[model samples]
Target: MLFVRKSYILPTAFLLSLIYLLFSSLPPAPEALDIDDREFSPPPKQNGGQIHWQKGREKHPIKSYIPLPTAAAPLPIPKIQHDFPSESWYRRRQRVNRQTAVKQAFEHAWKGYKKHAWLHDELSPLSGDNRETFAGWAATLVDSLDSLIIMGMTDEFEKALAALEQIDFTTTDATQINVFETTIRYLGGFMAANDLTDGKYPILLKKAVEVGEFLYSAFDTRNRMPQSRWQWTRTAEGLGIEPSRNTILAELGSLTLEFTRLSQLTNDSKYFDAIQRITDQMEAAQQKTKVPGLWPVMVNAEEMKFTDPRFTVGGMADSMYEYLPKEYMLLSAQVNQYKSMYDSAMDAIKDRLIFRGMTKDNQEVLFAGNAQAGMPSKEDLEHEAEHLKCFLGGMVGIGAKVFRRSAEELRIARGLTDGCIWAYDSMPTGIMPEIFHVSACDDMDDCKWDEKKWYRDVQRRLSKGTSAQNAQQEGKSLVKTHGLAPGMTDISDARYFLRPEAIESVFIMYRITGDKTLQDAAWRMFKNIEKITRTDYAHAAIYDVRDRHTPKLDYMESFWLAETLKYFYLIFSEPTLVSLDEYVL
Candidate 1:
């Protein structure tokens, strides 16, 4: 459902009635609340634990280094003007129960990982085995540390802190490492945990510094650009490495937030300087791309040039665009380049990428799609959407509010979010697939369902050898076989990877607009995902979200705990707990 802000207040008697109907059926409070006032003991010290860089090591005295500028004021938290009274006791209790439910789910998965795959990158919930997708560095443990503290699981947080002490950044089982994933999940995790605890735990910062040094080795090239995928083993051995000639936009552009945060915390400009160079290159190339405002998916990291004409806000380019506004906020609005770059990219996205999807119910939803350089015009937008692009709604929402953009941006954000919610509801298991195709509506404001057009589109996609009548008959069978939703004609990739993008946006929209309907949408998404993905140990990814009896993939990514459940918990908890005004989260 499209979320519209509540502009009116209910009468006292009607308010009470509404509360009773809303919360009376909610499950009773659990034995314990998700949050508590418990405190944690400091973790034991490591003996001079620090990674030594073999080359390009520089030290800046605090006196000589200038700290990044801070904003004059924090972004104001938006408040609904309606005179809805303070939360009723029933509503508060219901929120606590929902938060508790999310906390319990996190605990189940944490216990499973601790028991079955401690110190590994990820846990195979179904197989009860460990997998090292990201340097075998206890990714889930580190990633979930801040989430644990935010949920008031002090004991679990303390245990995770202790486990963090045993991690060795000097070595890894994998010869090569992905710089982007490591920076976000590992470095971002440690930095976030450190920030949440008010810097009480020195070990978190220490671990972060160690990981940062290891990642910094990727930038030791002729040019300051980093290797998207680095041979860490060679770097550890003091061997030489070069930046990749062909790298995606995300790998080169997503490092700013984490690296900049590290510099702010440690007062070392080395990390920030590395990423700033990349940002400067991106800004210089902004207008040089085939699509002037947007960067292509692939680029030459060494030459710092766009290498592909294909542009998308999906897989290879999502976080690059995502980090622009976030980095602006994180840097306290001191850097105007980030703002300029973000505005340019978003303008291109709104003009060339967004499309209206014509669903069977004729729902008016907007989706961010793909574009090619040689397209005849902006109207030739690809009608494919990816789950990863769902984050755009929240990103755009934050930009709109923080930058004081027009109300049109907020409206666009709502349409984008509604598109994702529709995808989830339209699926049989109530989870959007990784990638799917939809029928395009000619007009964004005036969309209509046309079954004949859908059938014709399907017929045209069939093999050339097939007869027209046979093609039409086969199209119907294909629809049933693929479990295509009413407006959908094909399923490109149907797997669901326990992603957090959709819920992430839902949580953000709820916070920014204070919309109760977004919470309802989040609750339905959580329940459907938990029901379909849960196993005896923990939740697993599904083979296909459109299948009623889909098999489970034996995988659990760290973001499942770090982002998915964390967002769910935050949405159900008090808004003041992680107030948007105080943090860039």
Candidate 2:
């Protein structure tokens, strides 16, 4: 009986020990929070404010994932002028109200696009039909993705995000597309969306890679200069032929921003190398040109040489010059080459391209015109300044802010900005024309024949490299002292495509100077634009800004949303939203 009892006790004890071990291995029950505590607790901070990741073994990390800046950069608060109502409450309320209005405007346009032109490159407000300016790639939707985030349209953003899956970049054909437009509108939009989303979507990076793979084919030339357009060959082994031997400056030089970011993100040198070759070629060509910073508007892609001797900061070359200072800032100022290029270009522009003219009121106005390599002609001098060239104003202002140590640059920026404003104010509608003629201060309005003394004075100052302050003072004196003849300016091309240059400059100037006048002017101009361009479906470009009743142009450019509206939105929003100190754009 004692032996049997000992056996049963040993077996029971063994079973009890096994049960204890199993219970000990199980996870503890989650601790209940204090009843009054917030429902969603913030992540715990550790090791100097870094949020601690949840304790776990990370698994199945993807190789294509590229980490973007997850935190908002520490940037300076853009200050309003102390002279303009010192009450902080007033300014805060103003900003909030402006932001709300801009948000509503954006939503109105977006809804119209989704309803009428969904999955298309552009919206034709007049026709309510879809158009494909961007290789049939639904550019409006892709470009609008980041703008949605900026406006805090989460529901629309998610819808657009889901729609991105339908965009199949893998399918290639002989359909040619503009490389520069695609890079800026599509590639830029994608990268921006990814950055704003804190890299939540790896799909954006993947699409960029896919698109870039085909674009690289444009660089496969003997001279390493990229063609303006690209298409894939039938076999898919090689790319389609170049559209022509000649390529424009903006098309070639504006690529560095997008491609360099791609390299940094993917750790791929091929993208960087492609654009680097263009930079190398431009640097070498800089030595060959008579002007230090300026190149001809057109270059032979095959020979890697400039084919056009005409130099202008307008049309096909504006963005190239604009990108120099921006690229320097975007790359954290590590690249000095970009600054050097910008300096030389500005010097060339001041020396050769700048022209001082007079209005009918005899106000001495300074303008930038095209420069010929040899000598100026009567017809060439008569060519009107384009609305596109007005971007020079903002570019100069931004350049001054970046190169702040240089007082002369600041003066130049101010002068150019002021000149652009004058151009806008001179028109009857207070909206600058697509193109307008400027002439010497005379009743005849023939600037080409007058050969005025102010022109010679401008040439002398430019040649001497006058201090920007002195140059600016001199410009003001030209306007104040030698008032240009009234009626000397005339509208040549009255059409308005809803361009963003003048408004963009106004926004930049307002931010830098803290001048409330600029904001007021922008608001008034925006109202005018809405009155003239608003359509039943969406806004359409007008045949003329001077005529409110002008015919609709029947086409809404993709840039209308991507750049124009986006700029306006940023302009009205709180400056800290995307502080220039932090964001390169």
Candidate 3:
């Protein structure tokens, strides 16, 4: 919990000595990704609407910026070629193979959920029982609807669509439902399917609108900031039930994309107005905050004020920041506010949150952490990164390319992407951990090599010979040698919740860069996940990624289908299927 001051610059001699001591027994650290070392200095006034970034080694490539919409020139709709074989023959075949594998994996989990936890929110993969979470809503089924459509599971999609009749978004049996979760999963899923199918499924639109109406009740507050949770059935007119006054940034900010899309589809401005007000309030309030582009994680609904001014791209506020640039892409480039906010936020992230740590071998490693206002005299600073935060890497990279931003910005995007991979690469299971400790090496007391067992295992495996004895040995050795257990720094908690952020970025990175290496890496990680997480009932979450024999956590989260499997399929699918250049997540 030690909080190091940014102003306290350590001498080179001290840092080198510490690094030498830490890596004396281990090999040199892996080559770190190149980070843009540009100085951040904002111009007094933006010239020609172009942002000025510090000149660096990377060259900024200029492309035609989509002009803001006007009455004379309407915003152009982004269109993608949905037909298969849009990519090269070899790449399309690779995608089809990967897509089939993902489909099988998803069906395995879905069959189990259907058999044991049908009509329930989630499945207990180990117990084969319903979890009854999320107000007894069929969360997994509803959440998986869009995924089924994406994967072309027609029969399964129809069956799931029919099953939706039993779901009632109106009544929650007095159980309070999360406004954010309900909106994102149910409303978002429904609208996504409706959009993907070109509104052929009226029922999906109907469900989304119904839930959107119930969700609208939470916006009854004076500030227009939606409450975190709501109990629609308990209230008359859905207005009497008092919603929570305090809410997190993600709940308030993440609504823009889905709600706005709903409004566009229905031609009802209320849905868009409900969320636009929140962003208007946010932009107005941004002037008073210490950091540009970043808002406090928590806010008071009643007062319409930020309560906790700590800035982070982590849980509770991650998606809020992500939606800024995306909203601009989805709606109109003329919505310059989205671009401004996103740009400022990126600056704050680079200036305050981003850092470089010297590994045991004096190698530089890039990592990002959260930043809080007002230095703490006695409190310890958090240097741990979460799996949820990994999505920022893809989001950043996607934004840079879509907006045709500076090359330095793209480097930041790639660097952050590499950082996410580093998290998985440094782990023992070759899977990303739920949470991990990241310490900056400053002195002998701070630098210590504790992953002795992992290093010894690596040495033993290396000495046995580089050549594999058989296929199993090859698979094991390949994963182990690359990242399976290339022990560097050990993580604190090693749970794998079947989260998709890492693979999600891999997919996005592959699409943006067209790098075959990314595709291969994703395949290796997919194999590792499939090998360890497969259970008789479903693909269960592991209690610890470090142990293949680790007990199952029992709970199968809805996102395992909604995001994880979806990303896996899309990563391997034809890149042009859902072109990153044309779409915003």
* Winning model by lDDT: 1
Location of the lowest summed lDDT over 10 successive residues in candidate 2: 1-10
lDDT of 1: 0.79
The CA-based lDDT of model 2 is what?
0.63
Candidate 1 error regions (>4 Å)? 1-85, 461-474
lDDT of 3 by residue, 32-97 (tens): 223354343332233464322221221121111111122223254332222333467777687678
Order of models, best lDDT first = 1, 3, 2
Candidate 1, residues 312-419, lDDT tens digits: the string is 999999988988877776765656688899899989999899998888888778898899999987667778888999999999998888776789999999889999
Error (Å) of candidate 2 at residue 117 is 1.0
Candidate 2 lDDT, tens digit per residue, 86-168? Answer: 43878768766765766666677778889998877888888888787777678888877777877788999899888887875
Q: What is the lDDT of residue 393 in candidate 2?
A: 72
TM-score for candidate 2: 0.75
Q: lDDT, candidate 3, residue 358?
A: 38
Instruction: Score every model by TM-score.
Output: 0.87, 0.75, 0.76
Cα RMSD to the true fold for all candidates: 13.1, 19.1, 18.9
Model 3 worst lDDT window (10 residues):
1-10
Q: List the residue pairs that clash in candidate 1.
A: none
